[model samples]
Target: MELIRAIQLLKLNAVSTAWVDAVWDCEFTDAEPLDSTVEDEIKEDVKVFKKVYKQLLGFSKEDSTQSVWNVFGENCVSVKSLVAVLACFVLGAKAKSSSVEQRRHSLQAAAVYLLLLRIPGSVANKVFHQILFDSCLDIVLKCWPQSAGKKRKKETLKSSQGDGKSGKRPKPPKKVSEEMVIDEEDDEEEEEEVYFSAQDLLGMREDVCSLIQTLLKLLENFSLRDKPQSADSCVRLFTELTNLEPLVGELSFSEKRDVDKLQSLPELAYHGLWLLCSSSNHGEGNECRRRVFFTDCCTLFLMMRKERAKPCLLPPSQAVCNARDQAILFISQIVDEQTEATLPLLKILIQHICHQIVEKSEYRASGAQAVGRLVTKMPCQNYADFVKWLFNYSLNTRVAFRMFALDVAMVLLAQEEREADATLEPDLASYLSHRFLVRSVVYGRRSDVSPTVRAHAMHCLAQCLELPSHNATKWIHELFSSSSTAGSQTMMETGHSEQTLKRGETAQKTALTFRTIELTKHKSLAVTTRRSTDELPLAAA
Candidate 1:
């Protein structure tokens, strides 16, 4: 009777402060090691609240009396409020339970109630993806042995030790008895057993993965509809979940040793990435939602980028890489036209392309291709910057990356010839000098050690020769002069050398490797700048 009266009093409260606090504090029981009788009492109280909540929903529909609605509304008897309260209830139940099975069952109950019920998706999604996810993540993070902080402190201590003078080695200890040795061995084995079991991390992974899968199903159900916001919500949840830094900071991993081993963490972000991308693809119909989705994904990529900087032995999560790939592909398809809204998107894509090119990820080729497509669509000013970036890369790194950068540059520079409407930005236009073009090509074709790079450099030179700019003819003259000068120098050196046979053979090979630009008139310069595939015939058709 007192429990029912207390529930009624909370319902009657009008102020947000009064009711929110009252309901939030309405846990089943505060006592630990709850007895059967206490559990039964708490369950009874929960049942009464559930019953009243249903009645309010039912009566509010049938009884359209404004007075009744106003009274119930004051008590905040909406679906969201109800879901929040029930989530609190389930979390409290799980926390208060001593048995692992009981806690799991409590969490399952929370999932079933929030997800399996025929509640409106808006209400259910908000609670399941946001509130429940956060609560579950908190639970999982707690399950981790709190050793991140201690590990950090240990690292700092080790680092600080290097700065101070080295201390003398301690004397060797005397041998202990066989019984003491056995006792120490037993303790070491016990610690190893606990570390290997990893029950907490396993249990947390199972529960969280289950919930994430359920949320993904809910997202799919809303896909193909005009639920752009729904898609946004799904992506937003993942963006928060996959990020570990904020969670680490909040949990203070620096101070604790709860995590048994540093490497024993579950693949939390890996599972969330695919879902985020697939769901976002389904929900990008609304313009506003699409923009927000892109922005949030960029943020998520940055967060993952930060995560990579932390020292870990494991390879990157495949899911993180896949998610980034999907984001690039998505941005490429959706942002068909360059606008102010997409400037940030283009910047991030370019950044990723540059990093991927240098890092040599499996997706580097795809990232480069995406950047290639983006360059053609970029605003004139941005395109100019991209051209300069490619130029810099080609000149700086004399490696395969430089080859790829030159290939991309070939496509960009040839865009003017391929499409008459294509115009160069002032930055790129002013820098298209005969000397700059000639110098870049001459170094690549003659100086680069790799045959493949030399081939690509030749292809780029061919494309440049076909360009219709005023400097094209001048570039041709300069290339011929440089090639002649190199050939003459090689002849003089070869003639004067004692080993004339070896020197003659080397000079012959050098002559064959020189930049061969054949000017043939075609309708337009259809230069095949793709060096990622099989080798092409050298003759410029």
Candidate 2:
């Protein structure tokens, strides 16, 4: 109680180094162990710190007018001193000697401090913000569990180091005792059991979630207009958070409760980024800064997806899908509002999507949908570049991405056709009508390695052939001629080795012949020389 009174007095009087040192030297015990049944001294220390934190922020139940900056101003040495005291406790929570419970209390105190900092007219000093941000981020990262193999390796290395002594150990005798052999086997068993228990893992995840929630709240309240530097720092924090992965292993039956908890980490980090992007004020002369911010946001989004793809037992959760949709919606909204300014960021996002498609990531379908949405929002002039990119990838060597790019191109074309007023640049128009794209689609449909790719290519070819400006006469002729040549070639091969022809090959020939006949009957073609199969000069069976 006396300590609380001293903090209140400091609010009125000018704070000095002596008072700061006294506060730091106060007997605040570390948190108790997790398994302890009773918490006595640590609980009192936590309450005292919470009271002091409220006092420093001028958050009072009785007197609400008092403010921290009112006493020492925003940049005074006294404010820095007070901030340092709180930051010290926050950092101390990350110490190796600190138990999980101690870390939790320290983080709770930090959260209170950050929460109060959100009040208007609170301390805006850069030093004060940096100190708290760094401390909180450090503690959160340390508390987040890393890969199991990494943790085991670290423990094993520590165990191997013999009491930190530099000298080599004496060699064992040639004939070891039976007891010695048993002890060695027991040591191996102990090393193998280095993983965290269910209780410890649960506690660590709770701490991470709590601290991340606090940091996210702080970020939401951060005034980007006045604190650009702080905004950058928050961006960095979320970027790092997105890269954090869960423990690497299959979730045992005991650890199922952790699935949702672990899933919440990425969702929270994603929401923080979404908040940053949505709340940014894109005024005149800030285009460069806006670009950097949006780029970082996009990069962080991709990084979270990458981290989620790592080997873990956590199935693809709904939280992840919702987060992804939210991100796409956010980007789409920005592009819709400032298409010109956000074009570069859009390109970056599309590039990442293309990368995902190439890698056959599980999120590739969503990525393709994102591309389609963003492209629909883009201006006509910008369509040429994206069209060119899609066409190039439609013929990609990777069959899956080739199919994906073809689908995206088909969607873009369909959208353009639906928008009656949309105009394409002359260069793009000519390029789209050229024979190269037709040939690429035709090749994919006829000779692609995968059946799925071939099917997608067939659909995309139909869309291309339906374009009003496209002259299907040449492509139709080429398709029929190629079909004829392929048919004649198949007949010769069958005649040369009728017994060697595989059943799969024969079925493929039949399917290909039917697909060719279907294309020839497409209504868009005005050919008059349609020939029946019996009149095409093939030998009768």
Model 2, span 152-200: residue lDDT tens: 7458666755653657784433563331121111222232223457897
- Give the top-scoring candidate (TM-score): 2
Return the TM-score for each candidate structure.
0.40, 0.53
Expressed as tens digits, the lDDT of each residue in 103-134 for candidate 1 is 44344434444343323434433433344544
**lDDT accuracy of residue 428 in candidate 1:** 68
- Candidate-wise lDDT, in order: 0.41, 0.48
Off by over 4 Å in 1: 1-85, 89-133, 136-236, 239-325, 355-358, 361-363, 379-381, 393-427, 430-541
Report the C-alpha displacement of residue 347, candidate 1, in angstroms: 2.2
lDDT score, candidate 2 = 0.48
Regions of model 2 farther than 4 Å from truth = 1-43, 53-64, 70-78, 95-98, 112-132, 144-233, 236-271, 278-320, 337-340, 361-363, 395-404, 410-416, 420-424, 429-541
